[model samples]
Target: MTQTLEQIASCISGYDPNALPVAQAQEFIARLVPKVQAVERVAIRSALGRVLARDLISGIDVPSHDNSAMDGFALRGMDLADDGPTLLAVAGTGLAGQQFTGPVPPGHCVRIMTGAVMPDGLDTVIPQEFTTLNAEGLVSVPAGIVRTGDNRRLRGEDLARGDAALHAGRLLRPADLGLLASLGQAEVAVFRRLRVAFFSTGDELRSIGEPLGEGEVYDSNRYTIWAMLTRLGVDVLDLGVVRDDPQALREAFTRAAACADAVITSGGVSVGEADHTKRIMAELGEVLFWKIAMRPGRPMAIGKICEPGNAGREAILFGLPGNPVAVMVTFYAFVRDALLAMSGATAEALPPLQAVCTTGLRKKAGRTEYQRGIVSRGPDGRWQVEITGSQGSGILRSMSQANGLVVLHHGQGHVAAGDLVEVLPFDGLT
Candidate 1:
């Protein structure tokens, strides 16, 4: 049975919607979403960036035999003398893909190349660079240079037969595809792509190519959100912008929930704004309006939205703030990980990089702050960060000029010059 939003929140400690901490809000969202279960079989070549639906087991041992790791002479380790070099006759050469057909006596060695199978009864290899061929057919081996099992790659050393190679919920990368191909697997099962429908709200917003009237600006949140979602490898449905009217919001919310796994919107989530969007969200499903203890983004909504008169058909809803910079900060702080979880991918924690602050920053202790900053290596060979010109939430150009966000955590006060701080980089996330 599915649990209600209130019930889930009741299980958490200090579940305050109005003054929720950043960590607690993240925990709440992590528990709210469910992983997608639909699976499809596709060729390994086409499985990059898709989540694995099941565990992959190896059917055969890698290498299939003990092979040479370098071009050397394969021989018995005991044949070398204790104090000086030992000489042995060079038998037939052992090239890769062709076995040595001739038999060898106790004082004989085989000339071997890299990747060649180790001849029977030989357990060591002396690299060709470490030895020299004498005037006769004898190959000279140095004493105490190599021991038994030197430069030999044993069978099943990489991956053994019947061992689990990849686990479920793994986001397959290029290396994973190569591993699957090495195991002779041509096809793999992966979770189907996640569908996300997103749009912008407010009467002051206009789409691109449309003439803007007085007090109106083109919507930039949708483009930023779309770019972020595209990097996560999800199927995006661009719903465009919906007005602030009740009827328009109702139609947009209904259609988004009906066709997508999650619905995302910007604007009309704050307390002072019009309540049409909030009322419609509550009417459709259980919604929670949160004033999360974070900067640039404070007023936000998180809940499940259902199609009209159909409770069984619903999608997760994330109503973000209206400001351009706030939209991006909130999405990275909350929405990015939630969508990855819902897509059946394993949760990967991105460890923030610590850098020395170049200047002092004034901050309060109650709320978390994400300041756009340019992080680079200083002349002293240390990672240093400085905030972009203005830290206002509406200044989108500062965010574009930044390479990372200087994260000032809650319970932390003002920072002085040369203080170490955490930075969430934009390399992979952007």
Candidate 2:
């Protein structure tokens, strides 16, 4: 997967790596992420939530011995009556983790418990519920009720020896911990956490607790990005807000480049008459300003920056939209996966779920639209979605109020009520 930017850029059909499409941008970011090569072995108990560095191979077969899958009588299938009912004397008991080693007579059966190893020379089992006990202390086997191997658990039934138990790049979950414990793994190899830095910029933007001057709004994008990055388990550095001045921005970018792996700014990439951030960004490194065919986050700039004190090292630069909602949309749509890649994670596609639209949606065919929506089960017990009150880029509440984002593709037309559309849920869908 080692690909130069040109090699990746060539895969796009129309091939404007500049005005990159959404899917192409996704691929480019995935290919460009320098997955952490450094690996450290941590105890399995401490490995939960960390990405595995290599495939986990099972050293031994699961259920290392042949065992019973149910509480039943263990007997040889050959000893069963082919057409008529049969009866056998209960000679012994086989409890779980215990064994029955006595030599049984021809007409004797072993009472076995679930998880107990099958008695020697036995191949079939009939549950105690299926057998009738008589005055003679014999168990009745109903005609045609039991089959050979019906309650037998073969050795290696759960997992075969030398099989790959878990693939690399997986974010270890609770079940993964159990699997590691089963495999007798005391420690696991994992990738190092990524280092990410973000900042907010706008002359009209004011940090919270500042004076409420005319034409000033609080800077909340930094907080949102901080929460999002923290959830990714990356080390985040908050660079605060940089004013519109070039010198102030230059110093911030320089310091950020030297200290962080990537720098994200929530503003100064649009086609407005007052955007000086792109110029300063280009002055420091190679950048591509794009008008992606997408809604709420059409204007974006991405590239690499090298500062003087960094000794020729470079850090990724993401110049996101200033609008509150647009910043979130672009981050979820783009930055999230890129950061995951940089952190040595595999590219995981967030597939959208099909849900009936409760309200109508009008969209053009040339651009992708991520309209906030509330997804829930309707009275019909079917999942449906409705757009939030306002999808304005500046209205952050639209995202806060909604539980999912309705993904309208570039080739899709206006959607009518009751029409099925694809939705990316905010919870669990990740």
Candidate 3:
């Protein structure tokens, strides 16, 4: 059974929309989103960045036969002399594909190249550089050089038959493709790509190449949202900008919810904004407006939006703030992981790195702050970070200049120079 927003909120120990903490908000969103159930089978080459639908099992053992790991001489371990050099006759040469069939004498060795099948009687290998070939048809093995079974690869060492090679919910990477090929798997079952519809609101917003008269600005939130969604491999539907009119906002919301699995809108979620986006959101579905305890991104709305006249069609809604920096900060903080979970992929949290702060920062004790920072290696070869100047929510240039965000927890207060803080780098965070 599908749970309503009230039912989900009732399960939490302390559910307060007015003063929600970052961790609590994350948990609430995680619980609210549902995974997409659609799956598709595609070739291994086309499965990159898609979540696996089931575990992939190996059908055959890797390295089916015992082989030589290096270019060396294959010999029996019992024939090595402990006190002095032992001489042996060269029986035959063993190439990679061509095996040496022999019934050699007791004191004999086979010259083998890398990846060549080991002879039936040989139990050890001495690297080619560790031995000397005399003028006669014999090789000299020095004492105390190698032990028994030194450089021979065992069969089924990498992957045994019927073993699980990859698990479900794994986002396939380039290396996973190679592993699939090694298992002789030509096609794989993966979750379908998530579909998301997003748009920005406000009468002051204008599209690119349009005239910005008096108090109008180009719509930047759409482009940024599109870029972020593209990095996650989701199919995006750009709905352009919706004006503050009630009818237009309603039509936009209804259309977006009808077509996409999730709907994202930026602007008009604040307390006293002159717009109908927030009203339309509430009128269309069960939405919860939040004032989360965080810096740069405080006002947000989250819930499920249902299309008008179509009760079966619904989409998850994430109403973000209007500022340029707040949209990005909130998206990375909340929406990214939520969408990954909805796509049926494992949403692994981005690990934070601890770095020394080079300057002091003033922070409140009750709110978590995400300060734009430039993290670098100090002169002492330790990780250190410095904040970018002017961290206002409207200033996006500081974010562009920063490579990371200094995450100060809700309980933390003032920070001085040389203090250690956690930073989330922008490397893998498109």
Candidate 4:
């Protein structure tokens, strides 16, 4: 028997994002979730933005040998005495990519450049400006300075052999590529990008570049969601726009389940005459929950799709609200964490900061609110957030001008101008 939305939510101890709290939502997803298993090996140069499948251990020392950290002269530390002028003959010059052969004799120094290997028997380096070159090819070092191992970079100072350079589940970045290259790692093993299917459903929504018919608007949610997914490093399978018909919704759901690891759609989940997504999802997969007690995104559906003739894999299904702002907020609030879990990322929540409210805000109790606000550093060097002009979910311009989401907890009524609030920065998707 298929479980209803509420029943399914109850079966999972912490499935309700609102009532169960944000921390619990994170814990439940982390505990009950398993990341995708497909892995791929690619060159380190091409592995940027890919999730690591295994730990990367260093095969050799980072510098490979002891090298000079400055352009100076290399000599024995005890050769110079305090307040005494010590003279030494210049033996050879060492530049990058070249090493000085043989050891430096007792009254001799080597002219070494930065990144050049320290010559044998040389224990210290003095800057070229500190030494005087005589016409007889002799170097003079001032006395009273007894420094050992100065301006020398030891072998493996950055990374040593057998040390783990990167751990599993880490997302590769540009700096990571340079680090891997320094360790001579030509290839890296990483998890393949998760394939996600997205679509927008509504009789009143039309794609861009199409003439608007009577009572129809452009399908802005699809493109918005696609951009967010692209920032998340997901391979998007765009299914185009689907009408609010049960048969069409069912067909799209089936195809999505067969091909995508997850499916996301905006609109057609609420209780209305043309909302057939809920009913069609019931026929295809079990609907987990709907109607969270949150502003702008109250009507949401979460489920797992079960398809015929395919090995059963839990395919996440999210039915976001129809409003443009609601769709954007809900995607960050709920879907982003789930997708990160699917990608094997442990930290799910967005980076948050504390900011002071610059204006009084009014709100009703018993429902959580995500108000768009502009955050900027005040003259006092403190962060101050102010709500935008409008708070309507249909106002897309408000989101455009906002820098972060000011969160109002449930049961909190109104906030004063100086009250502190938690702010989630809007630096784009993840």
- Per-model TM-score versus the true fold: 0.96, 0.92, 0.95, 0.89
User: lDDT of each model, Cα atoms only?
Assistant: 0.92, 0.85, 0.92, 0.81
Model 1 TM-score is 0.96
lDDT of 4: 0.81
State the lDDT of candidate 4 residue by residue for 253-309, as single tens digits: 999988888999898876674647778877777664455667777777777776756
Candidate 4: residue 393 Cα off by (Å): 1.3
* Ten-residue region with minimum lDDT total, candidate 2: 1-10
Q: How far does residue 118 in candidate 4 sit from its true spot (Å)?
A: 0.9
Residues 203-250 of candidate 3: C-alpha lDDT, one tens digit per residue: 999999999999999998999899999998899999999999999999
lDDT of 3: 0.92
Query: What TM-score does structure 2 among the candidates reach?
Result: 0.92
Error of 3 at 250 (Å): 1.2
lDDT of 4 at 353: 78
Ranking of models by TM-score: 1, 3, 2, 4
Q: Which of candidates 3 and 4 reaches a greater TM-score?
A: 3
Which portions of model 3 miss their true places by more than 4 Å? 103-105
- Better by TM-score, candidate 2 or 1: 1
Whose lDDT is higher: candidate 2's or candidate 3's? 3
Ranking by lDDT: 3, 1, 2, 4
